[model samples]
Target: MECIVRPAQSADCDHLMGMIREIAEYHNLLDEVKINSQVLSADGFGGDPFYQCLVAELAPEQEGKQGQGIGKKLMSEVAKLALARGCVEMKFTVAEWNVRALAWYRQLGAQDKTEAGGWHCVELGGEALQRLAGDRR
Candidate 1:
């Protein structure tokens, strides 16, 4: 039951893409996944990287089980990287209906900033993004 949490490599793009699709499917938002493995690799490993990613690799024989410390280890690695890069805080969003994930994040000392700090997560994409860009002209 040993899990290794490490930085993701370009070679992991295919596997990561699969995992991404799995989560999207779980949330019933498969159609929202527009990026493919190539995009994932470029975005994460390009000269100007958009984000950093960590991968948790478990033994081939081990079943992907929950309630283990694997997630905690991955988060710990992420926190270390953030701290090393002088980041003071980290933020992520979870679907409102995902009670289990919300509770687990809370257990990991994550706060509901949307509620406690009156923060709102906003996005503008696709046609809206194009329109906004056009307006700047």
Candidate 2:
């Protein structure tokens, strides 16, 4: 299957959201995903945009079959978009357990800063965040 990478449009909100949900689920982060079609469209196509997404589609090869090149294509496009949007660099985090993804990102020239301590990540989960939110109410 041939793959074609392109910029995402407002019409692709549903498909993008579906992909996002799938990825989140794959990473055991389904509960952390709160994105919907409306939110995706508004955030990506609205004023004061937070981020952008790239889409991959079949290039009409061999009975119009599409393949799974979306992730790579999207990564490339996101990097380009980030640079174009005045971002000095782009950043993404991968779980320490996701070796496949980590390898792929490294292959794409993403540096592994695991030893640098330049980045700090804070995650709220397992009822603590919930309790905190509830206590504030």
TM-score of each: 0.93, 0.71
Q: What digit string (tens of lDDT, one per residue) describes model 2 on residues 1-137?
A: 56677878999999888888988999888999877999889998998888766777775554422235667776777777778878887678788898988888888788877746666566798699889888955
After TM-score superposition, the amount by which residue 39's alpha carbon in candidate 2 deviates from its true location, in angstroms, is 1.9
In angstroms, how far off is 75's CA in candidate 1?
0.6
Tens digit of lDDT per residue, candidate 1, span 24-110?
A: 998999999999999999999999999788999999999777788888888899999989999999898899999999999999899
Query: Would you list the clashing residue pairs of candidate 1?
Result: none
- Runs of candidate 1 exceeding 4 Å displacement: none
By TM-score, the best candidate is: 1
Error of 1 at 76 (Å): 0.7
Candidate 2 TM-score to native = 0.71
lDDT of each: 0.92, 0.78
Minimal lDDT window, size 10, model 1? 63-72
Query: Model 1 residue 5 lDDT?
Result: 89
Candidate 1 lDDT: 0.92
